[model samples]
Target: MHLPPISLMLLQVLALHTLVFCCQASTFTDQTDKQALLEFQSNLSPNSRVSLASWNESFDLCNWTGVTCARKHKRVSGLNLSGMKLTGVISPSFLTSVSLSHNSFHGSIPPEVGKLFRLQHLNLSNNVLGGGIPLGLSNCSALLNNLEHEIPSELASLSSLVLLSLRRNALTGKLPASFGNLTSLERLDLAYNRMEGEIHEMLFLGGNAFKGQIPSSLANITSIREFDIAACDMTGSIPLSFGRLHNLEILGFSYNSLGSYSSRDLDFLGSLNNCTQLQHLGVGYNRLGGKMPHAISNLPNRLTYLFLGGNFISGSIPHDIGNLESLQTFKVEQSLLTGELPTSLGMLSRLGRLQLQSNMMSGEIPPSLGNLSMIAELLFYLLYPGLDYNMLHGSIPQELMEARSLVSLNVSYNNLTGDLPREVGKLENLIQLYVSHNQLSGHIPQTLGSCLSLEEISLNRNLFEGSIINIRDLRDLKLLDLSNNNLSGSIPGHLVNLSV
Candidate 1:
């Protein structure tokens, strides 16, 4: 065992060098991960705008564009190739975060993606990816997509999932009840899909072919604010439980077959009274019929827009509709409505647009309507208010001219007997005036010439006496029809010369 001190020192130095070499060898290059990334790059078509030329065997995987590695293990941790115009099937990699959104990437997302057990975020949105989402992605927290397949129920296992958007895709199949397991989810948009089944939360599934009844389970999503399932093939009355959504603000169920022509069909309107925050309600173009429910007037005062047109709804519009202090637009045209227009509508000081044409409403235009100083657009023509259609008898209300902001006035095809209001010229902003096909008798209002903004004037088929006095002054008139009136005298020479 006896040895020179220098020999012993040399052995110690050798031992130290061995340990250093072992440590360096243990920190080997992640060749498997690197090769996987290279394979993904190879699958995409070559794009002049997006070159992954730096992804090669010569360069460290961490140094590749769109690649990031963990600090300690130096393993690929994230891959963000968003908006790169990369086109190809997505290849799986052991990444924690993967975002290839807004690209031209097409083809099915490989099931191999599910192998990323550590994946926290995955976004393939705005791509043309087709095929089912793999169940293996249950570990992800944020799952966004542009996928065309059934939403896998396995997604319910992602307890940490918060945001899921599969909009503008051809996704089919029903929403799985297991989705209730995602307690942390805040926003879910599956619009423009072919998915069926009930919805929950702030759901937006418009422009989809979703069928079946809107589930009453939706009441459980008390936190929901916006629910839009319009343009779907849903049937059955709107769930009365919807009233429980006190926070709901916008509700759209238009263009769906949700009800039949019965009083019970609109029973849901009573439930909505609890939704104090409700502002917009659209249920037009359905099979809904029955008297306009008085419960509609009980809707939230914050309601600003109400559309109930294109339905079989009968009876008079609820006079209490004027209670909607915030009402801005009210559309009830093309329905089986009867009775006269409600004069209380004048109370809607904020009213801007009103559509009540194509109904069985008779009687003279309400003079109270003139109180609508805020009215900017009005459509009540195509059926004379006092002519052949509804048997309305009265003079045209001069009060209407008080609405200085009025841009359009339509009251044609009625059986009214009176002269046109001379104050009609007071509507300085009037661009269109339709009072044709009536039984009115009198000279054309001379003051009508003051409406310089008039672009269209229809006064044909009326029992008017005297010549068209103001016809010569409407220089901006693009259309003028004053024929069939009992007027006498030669046409004004200036009127014939105008470019109408």
Candidate 2:
């Protein structure tokens, strides 16, 4: 409290100045952010302008539309203006990374977007933005940019990319062979587009609509997990090298035109025995023929679903199929397979659905099928609901009734003779009943009315002779086709609503 000299007073004045300067510096940063917000708002629609302005306070940018700030106040960290009905082309000068996916940004992706060097994720999916992908994207150095445009060779520069989703766009042209340059990519989705060109070696197009021959090089991407090129118009042979993809889990090449070099080209399928991690393998709707490779039985116990339907595959189904104990859905419909149904099929303890229709399968319906119940609680559903076609001669085995969990029972278009099993009505969950186009039948079982969940019942073109009884009690029936059956009785007046 002593009165000091003028020198002491000068020192106190300097300390006050330092404090004021620090406050002013903070205020300046806030002002700068406000100015940027004003610029961004001016480019928006009147509705958007008002919405953004309400959240763009001078001291807080986090409240602004699609914006996320870091720990420090008012510093722009993440901007997500996606699906905002924004009409203008992206202005890279205003921000770093931007997302206009599923919006109305209808012009070409501005090349200026590449100028934002800090961009990490740019998603422009589900938009009308056209024109070739800007090669300047490489300048951003981030790997997660959307490639809704054609694959640009300049993308090789995004060596840090980890995920790229460009699916469901109008992108075309071949993938740049240099795609492996993005060595850090883990997931790539190019599905549901017109992307063509041979895949390069050591590359993965997981969840993409890539067409043309699968590149032998893809076998080198040992780390790929979910590889899907489904419905991509792909043709030519499946590469034998695919067996080397030890880490692949979900491999789908369905709905394509893939054909083998010759009838015995199934040798390539044997190579897949090494893909121990594969769980879902779909190569349906192709022209591959010959016996299924025995090595296919070597697939790991983890393998569950196997679809080889709609192909030209011939030969008897190998008993080794039982080795796929975890199989839940096994379909080989519309193929040229010939031979008796293997008794070993009973070993599929977990099989829920088995489709082997429209093939030259002979011999009786194996009693071994009854073994399905001895193994596990069956979640199986057999679907053969359709108009009469083809001939499958066999007795309706009572052994099938043991599958207590059966939800659908269709044995139509076959040569058979047997009385309606009263146990069939025990399937309380049966939704479809197709037993038409067969020989022999007794009185229509009134017990069938107990099948409360039946949605469809087709018993036409058969030699069933009896008055349809309690037809009105089948209340759940939506479509009932019983034409051309030998029945001596007047039409059930209450069944008018049952015919479809």
Candidate 3:
């Protein structure tokens, strides 16, 4: 009941009015965002089947299905429309951590997607989406994860991104040079796309993918591993600087246009000796030539897999190859290698698979091969041009049959003689056998039929004389090739009962 001074009372009234306006303004902003999102929801195809009823004035966005609100309750944090069979362009007004994967969304990604400033994760994979990647995606400053198509150069602006998966899309165009700017990226997968051009040095983070001259500049990102740049048409020899990547492991350069390597070609490979952690090196189907580097035998002791198939590798396999104690897989198929297989190969105690098919390797199969008891299969395409040049003589070593772990053996097209070893039945896990086109004589080992697990057997072009016997033991046989042999009897009647 005491009256205040005029100026003071007016000031108080103005202060209250200001507070009310601020509250109204805040409410208006929230409603505007809601309306924008609702408008977007309405534009979606009826097939989308996403109901906006859950997104109303009373219900909190965090409580809505496929919607997540920020901790501050100031805005929606996430929006997932995956698997909705959506068939429309994305709405630009909706700014949320969005996921529209596994949908039918088609058309070019809208540049407006870049407006989602607070977005952290955006997944639009497994859709019929086409067109160049939107340059605006770089605007998502908080982006930590992205699975989009047609990767945009603007994406390099996202300094906070961590994981990016862009696989299995029709994306084309060279990878933007700005990709090197994504310093925080970890799991980058761009497989099964049309990305071309040599990887820039900036993108080659040592142990990480990006073949060619090893990006000496990126050698500092030692945390990188599992680098894959396969099927990218990359040419030129591997950079020797890669050896600087001490923590590097699992490098893949398959299905590229790379040239054959020589001793000079292996300078990069030799440098890899410094990568003590290197494992699973794949350079298959490249043009790598020349005798393999002798130093290749001294690669990281931790090596478990080495694939150099489909190349022009010449010369004899280095005798020191046995030094790779940890090698589990060694493949040099389709090369021009000559001379006998090194007896030292027997020292590879951990070797599980050995493939030297389609090579010019000559001389008797080393008896030392029996040491590879862990070898599950041995594949070789024997090339014999008469008895003069490379006639692989001597009987098939009984020691080879001692490889009880052998599941499949392919030794076709050579001057191999003598009867098929009965010890072959000891391969309990044998599933496939190919001994065709050899001069092997005598009756086909009856014990071979005892291999119940055998799925296929190729004894064609051999002098396997004598009548066939019980084939019922080969219950699992899918195919049996006894054609071109000198066997004297009709096909065994019991073979009629097999699934083959």
Candidate 4:
């Protein structure tokens, strides 16, 4: 009823042949993967406690220890050889190769493990290897692992590593000079270690105690995007070679003695014009000098914070500073800068804080400064303040007081000689005003009373000759100094009932 006898018999024979072929392929894969697992366990150096006794033909390959097989192909897809007193693991990928990263093993990386040509990713980070490793890999993380002694030059052979995070280790000795050979390296994090020498990258070596100048060789890595080496105790000038890094975005050199206060100390800043993507530049508190670079005006408009304060910088702020439209903070106090405030500063509509105090600047306060329309989102920020402790003269610009976002104003210790503008009342959030030691005259504006948030007022050493205005509405007033002035009135009634 089905088919002819010979035809049916041939069809059955073909079906049986296909079944045998499929079984043979499956058995071949299992034996190969089983042998690979056994090889994996045998390669682990020292007396590894990785309980891999079950990785045998007696057990199913899919059910072997730390071995994971795919649901359909049933091929060895992952291996988590952790808790072997070691620090490596594996994962799935194409080429069907395996990986090893982030585990709790405690042996030196065995040469046998590296011999596996099919291995893909290997991250043996955070292993408490109580003994010694054959070599400390320089281009990968031994982070928080207490790996000691000098990093040998032989470890630089791992040229394929992209991120080498060796932070928070006790690894001592000078950084190996052979590190420059690793051309594939991008980010080198050597922070909080005792490694010496000065190399940079995305470069989180901020807390180390290296004793040399930052090597100019770092500039060869033009692909760098962020380079931060702050507080590393490295003296000497920043290499001008750094300018070659056209892709630099965030450069931080703060809290280090990096400059000599020479006339050209800060020339590196101008050299950064090619780094069009730069956003945050913090070079404050170094011994850097030279005039504020005119190229600063040409800095990327994307620049947000520029902190060059607490240095030996001289000359004037760049007149084209307003070009940094995205600038939020401009701090250059405690420098040797002179000359008048540039009118272009007022064009920084996004500027929220300006610190130019303790300079030798002269001339009248630029009236254009009031044009700064500080963003209203912040609850506290010194808006266009800190023009104090200079040789500035002339009256407080009424325009300056018009910046409604100003929270604190300090023009004291200058040679200014004008009546405080009544527009000050427009600063409803004003908390403090210091206009002391000036030649300001005329009745203190009653509008000052409208600023109910006033907490401190230092109008002393001025020529103000009238009674204190009725600031009874200023419930937050804490300190009021009107001394050395020619005022002939009693203390304001606002303070009369207070327990000062």
Best by lDDT: 1
Instruction: For candidate 2, write residues 1-500 as lDDT tens digits.
Output: 11112233333332333343334455345445555556545555565555455554543566766877656555565667676766544444333455666665555655545545555666666666666677776433222333355777777677777666665666677788787766666556666566666676434343345557777877666667777777766778888888887877888877878886367656777777788888898888877777766766777778888889888887788878889988877888888777777788778877777877777766667767766754445344442222123355667677776666666777777676777677777667678888887884777778888888888988888878888767576777788877898888787788776654
For model 4, the stretches where C-alpha displacement exceeds 4 angstroms are 1-173, 176-186, 189-203, 374-384, 472-478, 493-500
Give the clashing residue pairs of candidate 1, or none.
384-412, 384-413, 384-414, 386-414, 386-415, 386-416, 387-414, 387-415
Error of 3 at 123 (Å): 1.4
lDDT of 3 at 498: 71
- Tell me the deviation in Å of residue 4 in model 4: 73
How far off is model 4, as Cα RMSD?
12.6
Query: Which of candidates 2 and 4 reaches a greater lDDT?
Result: 4
Question: 19-40, model 3: which lDDT tens digit per residue?
Answer: 4433444544455556656655
Candidate 1, overall lDDT? Answer: 0.75
**C-alpha displacement of 218 in model 2, angstroms?**
2.5
| Tens digits of per-residue lDDT for model 1, 329-385 | 788878888888788888887777787777788877889877777433343221111
Each prediction's TM-score against the native? 0.69, 0.78, 0.73, 0.68
Ranking under TM-score, best-scoring first? Answer: 2, 3, 1, 4
